[model samples]
Target: MLEGPEIHRALTRIAHEVLERTKGAEDVTLLGIPSRGAPLARRLAERIERVESRTVPCGALDITMYRDDLHLAPARALGRTEIPPEGIDGRVVVLVDDVLFSGRTVRAALDALNDLGRPRSVQLAVLVDRGHRELPIRADYVGKNLPTSLRESVTVLLEESDGVDAVLIGPKRERGEDRTDEARTASGEEN
Candidate 1:
């Protein structure tokens, strides 16, 4: 439903919101939930720096082992988790993600964050918040609030990974059917 320019504008707005919410993001550390989140976090950091004239720590958080549905799925490759040297302790951590659907991924990210270190506070930021939350989680900063049916899927394609930036909505795949990673993410089967 969204194209490249629109996605860029949304990210720009989200960056500004993060700065405004955190009062300049002085002690904020953005931890992106890989794979798309990592790049998104970097982009946010860059935008924040451009506006505030200071660097914001950005890194990737891998939630593979912390997922609640690990037993239900087959073996999966773990993504890289890179924390800045400053660490999360006493910092306002913003967990960035591509799409928010059932909130499972965000929950998994929170669990993983707990194992790492204690943060002053934890907040969530997402490119698309396609509601149907299975958990009580909600995003602190959202690029778009997309209302969708349970049978439909929302996919976010980023330029860093997908070579094109777009938010697509389509039908969910049948059980055991082959689908792309984006489709899997939209179906709330992966993050």
Candidate 2:
């Protein structure tokens, strides 16, 4: 539902909100959940730098191994998790992601973060909050609050990986429904 310009505006706004909430974001470190979230984290850092004139450490945090539903799916290739050299200890960490759906991914990310180091506090920032949370979690910064059905899926395409920036909403395949790899990815089933 969101186009390139809209996404940029959202991220820019989120960057400002983060700075305001963190009181200049001097000790803030952004950890983006892999795939779409990585590039988003970089963009936010850039925007934050532009306004605050200071660089914010941004890195990728892969939650593949931390997911509770790992056994439900087949073996998957692990995503890269890179922590900034400054580290997350004693810092305010903001977890960035493309879409907040079931809240499971954010849960997995929290578990992964615990293994890494203890942060002073943790917050969430998302491009879209689809409102189907299965956990007691919420995002501190949200681009859009999209109402969607369980049978619907939200896909975020970033220019860094997808070569385009857009958000698409479509039907989700039901169990036993024949699904192709392309369809699965498009439906954000893999996100």
Candidate 3:
């Protein structure tokens, strides 16, 4: 769906869009969810710093503890949630995530943020918005809007985690379904 260069361009645009929407980062803070969102947040902060010529505060937010499906799934290790020194009490807090699927994660993030502190406003920034929204959630800054099927799967691989930066959309394989070259090529994955 997106390659490294595409991802870079998207982040750049998102950074500018964010500053424009908030009238600059004077009252902004970016909090990324764990896994891929953490580095994406840093990247956005870097871009914001370049455009604004000022460092933007960025931190990691772990929503494992606050997820609605925690009991439905097996137990996993909790992620780290760190707020900046200035805090989110009165800043425009942007929740950064790699992809927006069902909106449950964002919903959980909101619950988690509620425990932290009240922000002047809350916004969402996502690299890709794959349309299959299970809740009434929207992204303030979207890198791309991808329309996909419920039977499909979108995977975002970043260098920090997957050693590559690419967003691949492919069909979800069932048991005994062979991985074909067609799927690999279409998904932008090398066999």
Better of 1 and 3 by TM-score: 1
Cα lDDT of model 3 by residue, 1-191, tens digit: 89999999999999999999898888899999876688899999999998889989999998878877667544556667889999899989999988888888899999999999999999999998887777899999999998888788777788887778999888765522333322212121110
Clashing pairs in 3: none
Q: Give candidate 1's TM-score.
A: 0.93
Model 3, position 84: C-alpha lDDT score? 92
* C-alpha RMSD values across all candidates: 1.9, 2.4, 5.7
Q: Candidate 1: where are CA atoms >4 Å away?
A: 175-191
Task: Go through the candidates in order and give the clash count of each.
Answer: 0, 1, 0
Error of 2 at 53 (Å): 1.3
lDDT string for model 2 (14-106, tens) is 999999999999999999887778899999999999999999999999887887877875645666799999999999999999988778888
Cα lDDT tens digits for candidate 1, 1-191: 99999989999999999999999999999999878889999999999999999999999998878878778756566778999999999999999998898899998998888989999999999999888888999999999998988778777888888888998888876643553454335334333
Tell me the spans in candidate 3 whose CA falls farther than 4 Å from its real position.
Answer: 173-191
Evaluate all candidate structures by whole-model CA lDDT and list the values in order. 0.86, 0.85, 0.81
